[model samples]
Target: MEVYLIRHTQVAVDKSICYGQSDVPLAETFARDALALEQKLKQQINDLHSAKILSSPALRCKQLAEYLGQEIEYHPDLLELNFGQWEMQAWKDLPPEEVNPWMEDFVHLRPPGGENFVELQARTARVFDALPQLEQSPVVIIAHAGVIRSMICKAIGLPLSNAFQIEIDYGSVSKLVCRWGLWNVKFLNL
Candidate 1:
């Protein structure tokens, strides 16, 4: 399978804050970024006749995926990390005395009333396993940075603890091609 893992465009939020799974709106800059994203995808795929599009159910992702002007599957598993009660709060604003411990061990740390990275990996794995054969075409997934990061870690043999070291930027594209038991990372954090 040739998976084009995509991170959704920027949201309208403070850059210094954490906005995980908070149902935030997309930034106004998205209109321009969407056009560029469309063009970028065209450059890579060249022809969309054989491409399959899937996306996170998050409103921001759905809104950006509309640029494809084609049918898209909404998969709940592709969502960003669930921050629970921490949603929408500036990381720095939160009591570091309380938040630092969790941030230090991000992969295993579950937010208050939320799931940990282990749970996230399981959910994303479901979506990852469903990826179809890509030799016949390409598969495009519009999801969160964390989703893309986790997939990359799984495909490239990186430990979950090191997943965050892979900086998947918003509106960026990451690619992996699977053949037999091996997955070739075509691009990372693109």
Candidate 2:
């Protein structure tokens, strides 16, 4: 089975805003970005309609998935890391007492009322574990950068703390192939 992980297009929020699991608007260049991504995928997939589409329930991902295919499965587990009290707040404005510790060990530290990277990996893994069961060749998953990084970690046995090393940009696509119960990465951030 082949998996194509796609991050949503650029958002309209400020760069400093901590937005995770928040329904933010896409940038004004959404149409252009989405069209370019679609054309890129077409080179690999003969028919987008034949693939199994899965996406985060967030509006940004939903819109991209809808533009790709009509039959999409929205999963909450595909959401980005929850920021809790930090949601929609400027990262620089966050209390250093709270943000400093998390910055040191984001994998285990929970942000006030939200979960950590470990939690996000666990949930996304549950959904990823079922991908091989689907009767599809190329499985397209539209989600956030964090979710994409989590999947990469799960695929390669990489530690969650090092997930940031894998740069998944907005509207980027990464490919992975699962064979004999083992995952192999083909390319990333394409």
Candidate 3:
């Protein structure tokens, strides 16, 4: 299976805000960014519209996926880590006591009402593990940086704690190939 994981375009929210799993608007550059991404996919795949399109229900991701093809499958497992009560709060404004613990070990510690990285990884794995059943030549997943990183970690056997090191930029595309139940990362943040 050829999996292309594409992060959504820039969001309208401020950089300081914590917006995991929150519905956010796309930035002003959405159209331009989406167009460029479409062209990029077209180069790799013969029919952009025919490739199986899966995306998180988030508006940011949905917009990009719709731009690529009208037939899209939305899955909750593709969503970013749920930030719980910190949905729209500024990162600086979060209570230090609560943030400190999670900052130290976010893989296991939950942010008040949010889930940990392990949960995110498990959900993401479910979607990826099922890819073989679809028997599709190419699969396009439009999701967040966190989701992409989780998939990368699983693909490369990297630890969840090191996920941040992958650097998944907005509107970036990462490719992975799966064969005989083994996964290999082809490229990242393209």
Which candidate wins on TM-score? Answer: 2
Expressed as tens digits, the lDDT of each residue in 69-167 for candidate 2 is 989999999999999999999999999999999989999999999999999999999999999898888999999999999999999999999999999
Per-residue lDDT tens digits for candidate 1, residues 1-190, read 6778888888888887877787889999998988777777877887764688889989999998777748888999999899887788888787776588777887888878777777888899998876753344488899998888888888887888898888888888888988886888988655
RMSD to the true structure for each prediction, in A, is: 1.7, 0.7, 0.9
In candidate 1, list every pair of residues with a backbone clash.
none
Error of 3 at 33 (Å): 0.6
Whole-model lDDT per candidate: 0.82, 0.95, 0.92
TM-score of 1: 0.93
Superposed by TM-score, candidate 3 places the C-alpha of residue 171 at a distance from the truth, in angstroms, of 0.5
Q: Select the stronger candidate by TM-score from 1 and 2.
A: 2
User: How far off is model 1, as Cα RMSD?
Assistant: 1.7
Instruction: Report how far off residue 42 is in candidate 3 (Å).
Output: 1.4
How accurate locally is residue 13 in candidate 2, as Cα lDDT from 0 to 100?
A: 99
Q: Stretches of candidate 2 above 4 Å error?
A: none
List model 3 lDDT by residue over 109-134, tens digit each: 99888899999999999998888899
Residue 171 lDDT (model 1): 87
Clashes found in each candidate (C-alpha, N, C closer than 3 A): 0, 0, 0
Ranking by TM-score: 2, 3, 1
